[model samples]
Target: MPKSKRNRPVTLSKTRKKGREHKEAIVNSIKQALEDYSSAYVFTFENMRNLKLKEFREQLKSSSRFFLGSNKVMQVSLGRSVADEAKPGIHKLSKFLRGDAGLFFTNLEKEEVQRLFEEFEEHDFARTGCMATEKVELKEGPLEQFSHEMEPFLRKQGLPVRLNKGVIELVSDYVVCEEGQPLSPESARTLRLLGIKMATFRLQLVCRWSPDDFEAYREGLDLSDVESS
Candidate 1:
């Protein structure tokens, strides 16, 4: 009788198992992040390297803010409905998570969030090597189309417009304002003229919280009313 042929059964490798565990851990952390955070802003870092990334993290740490992991992890943790509600109208961000993706989590004052975002914008603008790939791009056409709607606000803010190569520029410097805080009539007008819009995320405010408000503040508020209210 011929000997019977047999095949060895394959066993799972430790390395593969470990990798799977690690991924699951990351996913769980992402889920926790979504559950705990009241607000989050998704951002992608372009050309950001060691020192710059450290500085950025330090800045956020100083303000009690933190960035969570990738969008897939976040989505897995948050589920579609919660994640969609968190960012509202900014679904475009979902596509841009291919790069160094993160979500800025904070329970800080709304103005602080706005201020942080503005600071991030300024930092990106100032950095020669960094670029914003996912930012909201304002085209000349929109500016021109809305100029009539924007002019009154600009005039009220006492900001003059300069025709720079056929583009309008705000003539006056404006200060950042938080939710419920009053903006100088001129500043409000200037903000309007500049075509600033409401944050797509419900948790995101246009301004930071004032130190004074920090003394008794209990919750966050809409930042869109910064100019009007």
Candidate 2:
């Protein structure tokens, strides 16, 4: 028999074990992301300098309840259905990961999430951002089917429209559609026509629980609405 050289076994130090534990914690967090999180939004920032990214991280740490991690790790941790559905979108996000990749998780109603996105659209760093992807579906029916009461109101918000190629086109340029931002001439007219009290940026309502669950959460009383017993 010929003598053979053997390699020594690798040993993990305390720091390495701690690192592994931390990674597992993050994975667990991602696994729980969809339990009560009926609403999830994926957004990417363009031209986000390191300082700005740090500031954004602090801002998100303030109110949201979610975890952000490497796409590959998160995809592996997520449920099969969620992972499958998000695969294409996650792939799209992989390109943006060079800068900063984040997932917003919440049980809040989709409309509320949309409002938050709009509210922060011009927060010095979010203007350049766009709604990367969403899961919510806006059903099509008669104009009245969706909601007509807001038509008159929306018309007043400065949003103008024209019949272009069998679709309504906001005659003016695109508007910020949110506070602290400028509006394009055409978007202004359309928004005014739509009577939007607030701006509707590219903020999209991504995936959410069924409409029924969402409606119940919306209508149910909150702590603010409760009286002392």
Candidate 3:
């Protein structure tokens, strides 16, 4: 039987890099989207939630494509200057891709895209380390909202909770969270249990680019920022 070369020794090199081919693929994909769509916009997001973003993507999947990845790859795809730009006036968007932003390619009319981006928002329970949007308190009384079985859990969450006659009771007024303060792990979990949503996920449109026109909708990103960089 011939000796099989299945057990080959692999190099344990420490210095290795990726994205030569991956970057090429991304560049191609962005170019294809540009060719298919009439307009492109740079959008920045806050309090990102993947599930919510997934739902939003489904809503516009038929008419739009969203790209969220390395800023470097995206910038390269759109080009850095007028000389090398994949599409005319698109390099302007590359200027605002400096932070928590993404590229959106869409076939929908400009008015429709503006409306959707303006109205799109999602609320979710705040997490630990997130600033509390408002103070959350519990009064000294029976907590009819929670079952008696939740007394231990509530107590563990730093709440003055007890179980009396199969009812969850708040023995004293307690503050689970305070406005402008970062939420603790216990407080975050407690807020979720109480069905309080304090975090908002939103995307802000920064600028729009097309074959014949370019406009920036937000301030703070301009040609000065581009020149300074």
Q: Which candidate number maximizes lDDT? A: 3
Across 1-229, the per-residue lDDT of candidate 3 in tens digits comes to 8777997888888666665897899889999999999999999998899998999999999999999989989999999887889887788889889789999999998899999998999999999999999999888999999887788888888888778899988889999999999999999999999899999999999988899888888876556755443
Ranking by TM-score: 3, 1, 2
Task: Write down the TM-score of every candidate.
Answer: 0.37, 0.35, 0.84
RMSD of each: 19.4, 20.3, 6.6
> Which lDDT tens digits does candidate 2 get at residues 138-229?
12322332244444444455434334344444455534344444544534443334344332223322323332332112233242311110
Candidate 2 vs candidate 3: which has greater lDDT? Answer: 3
Error of 1 at 172 (Å): 46
Local distance difference test, candidate 3: 0.89
Clashes of each: 7, 31, 0
Whole-model alpha-carbon lDDT for candidate 1: 0.44
In the range 92-201, model 1's lDDT, one tens digit per residue, is 23333344666565666566666655555222221222222233323332235444555555445454545455555555543434444444444334344445532222
Task: Give the lDDT of residue 10 in candidate 3.
Answer: 84
